[model samples]
Target: MDLFDAINQRHSYRGPLLADPVPRTDLRRIIQAGLQAPSGRNAQTTEFIIIDDPVLLAKLQAMHPANQAMQQAPAMIACLIDRQPAAVYEGYNFQIEDCAAAVENMLLAITALGYASVWIDGWLRLEQRADRVAQLLMLPTDKKLQILLPIGRPAEHWPQKERKPFAQRAWFNCYGAEETPCQ
Candidate 1:
């Protein structure tokens, strides 16, 4: 599918993914797509840790709450940032922005490849718990774990989510005013 088609078709997938392993080549392609996303000052701070080992995946899955579906995913990605880079700037973490864009690109690519994915933020953790997760991953004390993404072939079909009419969400050169769906 073309870029536009991929964008339109992409959505969050939290259901079961096929047990089949994602091909290394395809995984590389997904990572490449992420790298292609724009970065802050070209900082390109995002880093990806793709986890496929069942044992390791199992361990990580155990760290979370009752999310059986997470254990079933054939692949998972840990989006992280180097604190050193972000520290160079005051109140700016380019890695988070960079990785987020990267993940968005990968999510779109996943749909294009007839797969599914979900963005599971690690933000649900309290400070202490979040720190534990970082320790488990052996990330530096300064580095941060942005999110965990589970990806695979969806076991069930899902429809597009409901949304407010475009008119209600858009505006004309101002906040909350007249604007048509097509502009």
Candidate 2:
């Protein structure tokens, strides 16, 4: 699929994923797309840990009680942010912004590659869930787990989610000025 089509079609998939294994080449391509996202001051604090091992996947599934998507997904990408003091830019931490960009890029790539995934955040960020997940992945102390993406073929077809009308959410020049819809 083309970039525009991929963007339009991409949705958060929380349903079951097929049992088929995702090829390593495709996984690498998806990761590459994420790495290409722009970073703040070239801090490049975003890191990814690809999980495909069945045993490890099972462990991860057990770790996240609120989410079952990982239980069936053939592969997952753990988005991490390096929180070292030196990783900051302009006296601010851009880990969230940087990682979000990477996640969006990977989501589009996943769509283009004929697969589905969900950008999981809140579930992993609750309480000490992320910390436990980081431990399961054996991530270092400085590496903070921010999001998880489960990748695989969807077991059931899903339609794009309904979005707010352009006019309701967007404006021309000012915050509440004349509405200007995208062409």
Best-fitting candidate, scored by TM-score: 2
Per-residue lDDT tens digits of candidate 1, residues 59-85?
A: 777765455457677788777777576
- How many pairs collide in each candidate, listed in order? 0, 0
lDDT of 2 by residue, 1-183 (tens): 889999999998888888999999999999999999988888877899999999998888776555546678889999998757464556787878989999999999999999999888888777788898899999999788999999999888888999998878878877766756445
Look at candidate 2 and give me any clashing residue pairs: none
For model 2, what is the C-alpha lDDT against the true structure? 0.87
Candidate lDDT (C-alpha), each: 0.75, 0.87
What TM-score fits each model?
A: 0.83, 0.92
Q: What is the lDDT of residue 124 in candidate 1?
A: 38
In model 1, where do residues sit more than 4 Å from their true spots?
Answer: 84-93, 122-124, 127-130, 179-183
> Which residue segments of model 2 deviate by more than 4 Å?
85-88, 179-183
Clashing pairs in 1: none
